[model samples]
Target: MKFNEWTIKDHYPEMALQDIQPISLRAYSLLNRNISALGPNEGAINLLGALEMLEALDYHFINFTQIEKGESPINQKHEAVAYLNRLGQLYFFTKSRFTKKYIPDSESHMPKVIEFISIRHKNTAHRSLDSPQKEPDEYRDRQAFTFLGATTRKFLGNEQYVFPNYNKDTNETEWFYFTPAIDHPIIMEQSYNLIEKIIKELLNNL
Candidate 1:
């Protein structure tokens, strides 16, 4: 489905109104300073990493949106995993580099950002056999396994996949199923906002 037709567009009108090229150029311009002049002690290194991750987030977002309905399940899953991975990495940079002065953890959207991070940690970054009981109870029962294309179902025939979880209790571990816990566009929008705030703050400091 097209981005404009998605319900998420209502919450992020700027996505439709503004072109990404200018925003990307602005971000690049802000980070284009000489690293040697800034020195090793400066936060330029962190900002550079954050900037790279931010660009990656945008790339994955665009790739996912461009995917056609009824496309190859492999392609669909690839975009989904890629987008979520970059989302988590960018959020990490925001917190570790930007700090609360720029983007606080108390923000309403932070929970969603952290959720994506946890999801990536369990599913992609560090897959495990058993779920760790943690504060975010949602992932407590989730196990780490390869997400097969057969396990994915399209969301309203869109590029998005609604992953279902398998009933592992039956001792049949051949399949892994998952209920969809993410709103892709909403998280993408929120992540972009946070990253933008961090980039602006970094530029101001520089």
Candidate 2:
């Protein structure tokens, strides 16, 4: 789907109008629209940097995953998984924009593309290679490797996992990453504004 038509609600059903007060929901929707409009080409805001910058903007941005969803599997584990999966998908989509805009002639740049893909695969493999330990915690860490995005990792108390995509060729996992629900309206607004600013700044440099 195009960025302009995407909504937080599609991914985060927990935050329905009935779930959150109307005013908050409105604010959230507005914010989501704003962020959705920031295509990578328009401002060149790459996914990894954008996500990290958003997290640093404020405490709310960092803790967005922890917000109460009033649903099953609502613990930190679920929240972490949900946020990570959604964020990864977000990165993937944003990366596509970047690729289309910057690497328009992929056929001409096949070698370069292959090199890039190799680097990306290496990075991801480095992060998720088979573990040496068989303990439950190690297993949880591995699951985190598979499920969480770089932005969501810090929130889940794992700060060492870096954004490893160098070639953007890996597609071993798929998860729907998005906002938790309609209750956290502030996030929608914050994300939208932040995305706009980031895109604008990135475009200026490009």
Candidate 3:
């Protein structure tokens, strides 16, 4: 989220293909490749900033087939899911590079990944943190968190959750915190690997 990223015209990867999604393109543009600027990363936002930053990217699931400018919630989600499912199937679920084929897995959880992108975009990227009624899709988010963490090198396992104690009271969640995994450095490193692959693959074939 730096000005220089946008200021440098050369920083953008040209989209020669019409099939390339705009949200995905902009997500990469927002990437901060250099960590030196971070100084001493002590806080959660700074510590897991790379991961969270990527996670927070606006992944609008656009369905040209079912276009809705201003419509009902049900139609919105349905069309979005349908479109994103198609996108996932093409880009992520099937790991084919020109010739070589690497089928993802028997139990590829791409649907959940799409759902997370939807929920996360709405609850996080689209709104302020001060908004009290955050969407409750923590379970849906687990697959995304797991996949992102596992794809990276050297990471231990853990489950995440949310809860509360109450006399109907615990002030506003003015602040929040979560412990990042010990192998976060590895996660950040692998993200670079993923980014490079994505940029090269999505560019003009000519």
Local distance difference test scores for all models: 0.50, 0.38, 0.31
Clashes of 1: 6
Which regions of candidate 1 fall more than 4 Å away from where they truly are?
A: 1-18, 21-26, 29-41, 67-71, 104-109, 130-146, 162-185, 199-206
How much does each candidate deviate from the true structure in C-alpha RMSD? 10.6, 13.3, 18.7
Give the alpha carbon lDDT tens digit for every residue of 32-63 in model 2. 54454443334323533444433432323335
Model 3 TM-score?
A: 0.24
Give candidate 3 misplaced runs (Cα > 4 Å). Answer: 1-23, 27-59, 62-71, 91-94, 99-195, 198-206
Task: Please provide, for model 1 over 46-141, each residue's C-alpha lDDT reduced to its tens digit, 9 standing for 90 to 100.
Answer: 555655665676676567667787777577567668866776766666566345665566255565666555556656554344544332333333
Q: Sorted by TM-score, highest first, which candidate order results? A: 1, 2, 3
lDDT of 3: 0.31
Q: On residues 54-171, what C-alpha lDDT tens digit does candidate 3 reach at each position?
A: 3332233223224455554445333333433333333332233421222224123223343233333333232322343433344324323422332222224422211121111543
**Candidate topping lDDT:** 1
Candidate with the larger lDDT of 1 and 3: 1
Which window of ten consecutive residues has the lowest lDDT sum in model 3?
A: 159-168
How close to the true structure is residue 146 of candidate 3, measured as C-alpha lDDT?
A: 29
